[model samples]
Target: KRTSLSMGEIMTIDVFVERYKDMESILNDVLEGTGANKKSSNKEQELNSRISGLQKIVSDLEKEKEMIKRVDEARLT
Candidate 1:
């Protein structure tokens, strides 16, 4: 029987965190690139709105993934 969370599980969490950070960095760059044009504040507003929606979805998925992982680990115990 498994005594603890497997190496694969640990690695998967690490990978998720790394990818999340990478995505955040990419999103920040996109916002910065557009923000350089101050006259397009309206465009920025629309972009921010869309980005927020995407961010919310990502965060929700992450939360669900974490909850599932926790439940799996509990079952393993």
Candidate 2:
């Protein structure tokens, strides 16, 4: 059995294959986030730590509403 494709079609396919390979490499990097950027991973960790700390502060503030109210009133006076 013989299948035939025109030269233009073959060239188009080659171009698409090369572009698809680049896209696949980018996709792989996205899927494997651990290797793409050490600084980004470290920054993410630092942001997570800051988020945890901010959450603790919010929790503490919520638990100390009475003290906060007192402070607000004292500031007004």
Q: Please name the candidate that would achieve the greatest TM-score relative to the true structure.
A: 1
1-77 per-residue lDDT for model 2 (tens digits)? 32434447545555655555565555455545743566457655655555455455545544454454566567669
Best by lDDT: 1
Clashes of each: 0, 0
**What TM-score does each of the candidates earn?**
0.57, 0.38
TM-score of candidate 2 against the unseen true structure? 0.38
lDDT of all the models against the reference?
0.70, 0.53
Candidate 1, residues 12-46, lDDT tens digits: the string is 76677666666767766777898997845887777
TM-score of 1: 0.57
Q: Which stretches in model 2 have alpha-carbon errors above 4 Å?
A: 1-3, 34-77
